[model samples]
Target: MTVSGKTRHRFRCRYTSMPSPTSSLSSSYRNPGGSVSSSSLYHHASYLRRGKLVLGIMDFKWTLVFVITLLNLQPSSANGNGTVERKVHVGFIVDTQSWMGKIVDSCISMALSDLYLRNNHYRTKLVVHTRDFHGDPFLVLSQALSLLQSVELDALIVAESSGGVKILAGLGSRVKIPIISLFAAAPSLSFSQHPYWIRIGEDESSQAKGIATIVEEFRWRSVIFIYEDNDSAREFLPDLITSFEETDTRIALHIALLTSSTDGDIIDQLKKLMDLHTSVYVVHTSPILASRLFLNAKWLGMIGKEYAWITTSMITNFVNSMDPSVIEAMQGVVRFKPYVPSSKAVRRFEIRWSKNIDGNQNLQEIELNVCMVYGPMI
Candidate 1:
């Protein structure tokens, strides 16, 4: 099930939704607490559901906010010069409690810290003001307006596919300040029309082509598309579906599970999918939710030689930081890794990011947004 309005119509034009499977698997597995199942998968799913899957980022947010800035922010006055560094007031609106929000907050802070360290001669310093909109569109608009009026914000950063984007884009156009997205925005947010709106990440069309190519190579005739029910997933689906048509692949089923779905709810939906013969499933969700999904699927016998799984870059980018159990459950899954150009500077930034994480992750840095943040600074 997908969302409505123009997007829904566009998606439906290319999709043939598999016969509404078993009415949500009859939702019969719900427990007295609604989700506190005594099963092994439930334990893992619960941990992830609490937003603990991202590990260090959650615990380190406060430290990043308070301690990292102590890396010595520049005062309004430049060192030993009559000229002052222009403090560009930038506003960041996100749900800081969520997985994506935490990363954006930390990445921007680290990226800025790194920026000032090497380029000491830079004339402009970004002074960031963040507001947690708690995933509410109304809050996004309100917080955005507050930041604009209170701080005289020179620019705004928000999730490209967030519900708040349209609202903020309108505001940014009126104010004539840049509205930058944290990651690659989908096709819908055309940059041609709205010059102030900026998207940073892998090109959306290229991402779609990559996903379709993978599926085509694997010869998965009809696959199940499972994604988190969010603005990002909605924005991402149209291009992917179109790409599928070019590859002559059919979407047998597409299930949009809510970001807040509990273990029982998720398991019930997975059970419904089992009724279908389709053995391939494509998942597009955050690492936390996707981890939880895989754990439950493995426990339900969905992870095996008979089945194959593919994940979008959203989940793959952060898989290095996921728990061993979650990673174990994801064994043999295909992932679309976002490509970042290799250079000494990129390598240096990756090393610094690894150290800042207390060595919890040794893999290459996947914070495309970090590179994106550097754009405004230039």
Candidate 2:
């Protein structure tokens, strides 16, 4: 009726060493009167007791009866009965060291947890494995390969803001694994080129219309455009130019700032723009570069009520995460951001996320697109 410590250890070893269910049941010994088997006793002894044992049924026959009753009480993976649960392994590759990457990782983790916790009938457990690329392209590829080969992930979720996503998407296609992107938004990485690639971020081209609308509403006939020299910005610039032309808004000057641009280089560009008579400007670049440009502009006294500064969604998406000084400099700047609906689920998620990254003072807001895209996919 009671299993000793040694007996319990022996039972565990035997149970673990046993072959598949398809094998013969000769290893199992059945009790007298066809009441219960040794296997059933082992199952009950393993789970029924807590820290201390209190067996009301001291007789072996009664113990066998209780074991049968408890075994039947176990939950089944299937809707009916006698089914095994399936497990899915998913990989996340992102720059966890960065602020935005940390936010994305947190959102993905919360999404996976919410999904499995709410859906009991799913019968599929999602195991998430994460790797930090540290914002390096080569590291991203290497880590991705390791996930594919070693981890054997069913799918991959990548959050990146660089040009390396094309290579990453290609690798996902080559391995026939779905690559869900929460950050990359270049139109060139469309579904046709890489069928395995799925983007949740808004396409850069789509924001061109919004920018044009803002320009037309303000009656700005001509405006200077400043953008980073990256694939997304370059691809977006042409579309924005076309949209401006359609709306009869001429782009008086277009400035492309390299990521490695020095302060002098930025100042030189700013000086040129300052000399121009056009007071309206449209800036499309990363949050870092945008902050730097605005800080320089503030020092030059260009960011004022007289100068109307309009930015695309790229800068607006990370406005809250920018430095206080940078935000102050661009106080009068106007931007159009994607709207996120208010819900109890979102509010709870926001509170949880805020606590997760509480130590990170740099990240003040969550990127809406990242949260939006993950909502439906998970």
Candidate 3:
């Protein structure tokens, strides 16, 4: 399922071969039009027997030249600042299972295809992987490393949810290439040991600090933290609670331990918190769990005036497919502000990107920002 090595490895695997169109034409040229040309038919039979279409050195060289030329036509580059030109064959290791991964992958693809690469300048390829960690971060890290090893790349783009980040941080030293984390929340990955790793999304520490600011602004005396008791919550909840200590906030931790996170479990948790006089109720959970909370809250008629719920930015995808009334009702009540994009610049790029991709504007702002920034630089 995965391609390995610079050269194609021959195996005892079933495969088919086809003759070159040029050779087929050449043999036909030597004979008059008939039921079949003898030379052409012989070459075709030979190709089928070989079970592989092997291109000559000249074709390989031409392909390399074309790819190089395509990679060179970027809108921005290190050379723009009069710096020495250092080209890169960037590889993106994306998780196709997650919503954010798909967004980042599409953006990278659109940026490469529509940017200078299409014009024959900068060379880039996106290597899509899957997030099948099942709450284990190590699985994600291993998959990324394995896929990365298969590609010839100068940089790697890793897009993962929480569990994925843990795996990547653990495997930080082993991954020699520059790895940029896209839409990740793990803060530990930003440590000095992994200098090549850059956080493309808001780090957990930054997000926790941001929430602390909100808590202070509202002058909430007592805070209640409810998390979907999973590995991510286990890893982050303590750090998040501790982050509030810097602001002199007292946090009452509430755990809704769910094996499968059913609607009943969510409502049951809300019932317990309903009587608590906490002003801010911080939800340390996924958007799937967030949607459950919102739905249960709405059904119980406690969404509007009772308690204000705050969660992570993961709810953006869930918000899109939510009930319109639920979405509107949860706006101020359940808020998670993302990094604000400058409207003017974003609009301009949206128009241009839409035109290039040949469709309507349908990309996340962060992903679009990556495209805008790197499109010119690649």
Candidate 4:
């Protein structure tokens, strides 16, 4: 029994807070024959060992024969017995050229269908809407809105960089549906005008709070924030610096306004910072920039127990994915924003998606973060 198509009403789950994708499943049933109580099964779903998804099996009985058949079938969206198709539509409007943009897009594309199918018990026809914020974001967003306004979408998931907030602001009153915003750092999001808009990514304020936590936890006496000269950086850094200042934290601020600077100059300025004996040096930039600094630190033999370096979570995962040698030097030295998945649900989703998607079994570092905010499978 799979529910297909968008219901006029959102099915607000009885249990709706964020769940650990890796949490242990607490219950299961043992019905010998075909029939089982739908009430019990629906309320307490059976998941695989480590919260991995059990694909194609909604709240229903599966005989041993059918189970084996499903297990043997090549995993994909279509295919497998006991699977009911439910198409979900989602749209992401964001800049695709940047590293973060590319990552967000890839994460959503790879994980959405498989995750939604397993978690929500429905197959999804994911429709992503994207736009680059390079030129006039207003124009790009307006175009996106025009396309989406008429489409009979299940749900609209919009993603935008910092610059795309105005677009979100403009669309707040015009579009009348559940809108989930990704990577949105709009000042207005805190208010009621955009009630439908829910932000899931680590905003600058959250990033700052995370930094302040690390600073206080480690008892790093003093800190210096090194940032690029850009509107986003400038806007966020001051608040971050202010948050750390509450403890009367010793802070030094340095600006690297590089419209076009050679790698040597970049490294040279970092080398000078290395000479400062700052307890912890923070870089509020993208992964590319963070990696450069990490590499420079490694080259200068500046990475060690003596100097603790930290940055926002945006760069931490990328740092971990770098070359082993590069990773080794900075291992345990960097930390990213932390959000644990429902261990029980995650294990269930993995198993389910694995069978559905034909055994593409590697699940480490896959992004289901979008799934967290935009509950729609698509």
Measured by TM-score, the strongest candidate is 2
300 Cα displacement, candidate 1 (Å)? 1.9
lDDT of each: 0.61, 0.64, 0.50, 0.49
Q: Which segments of candidate 2 are over 4 A away from where they belong? A: 1-83, 364-376
Candidate 2 TM-score, C-alpha based: 0.73
Model with the higher TM-score, candidate 2 or 4: 2
lDDT by residue (289-327, candidate 3, tens digit) is 676676777687665433456665445434554556655
Clashing residue pairs for model 1: none
Candidate RMSDs in Å, in order, are: 13.6, 27.0, 25.3, 16.5
Off by over 4 Å in 1: 1-81, 135-137, 359-378
lDDT of 1 by residue, 9-110 (tens): 100000111123323221112222332111322223223211111111112234234323532353465646677766667788878665556555666778
TM per prediction = 0.71, 0.73, 0.62, 0.60
Q: Write the per-residue lDDT of candidate 2 for residues 109-208, one digit (tens) a residue.
A: 7667777678766655667788899978678788888888887677787877577788888987899877867653565666788988766555454456
lDDT per residue as tens, model 4, 99-152:
445545555655655555556743433455555554345555675676577564
The C-alpha local distance difference test score for the whole of candidate 1 amounts to 0.61
Where model 4 places Cα greater than 4 Å from the true spot, the runs are 1-90, 95-155, 175-178, 193-196, 228-232, 256-261, 275-277, 348-378
* Rank by TM-score (best first): 2, 1, 3, 4
Which candidate leads the pack in lDDT? Answer: 2
The better candidate by TM-score, 2 or 3, is: 2
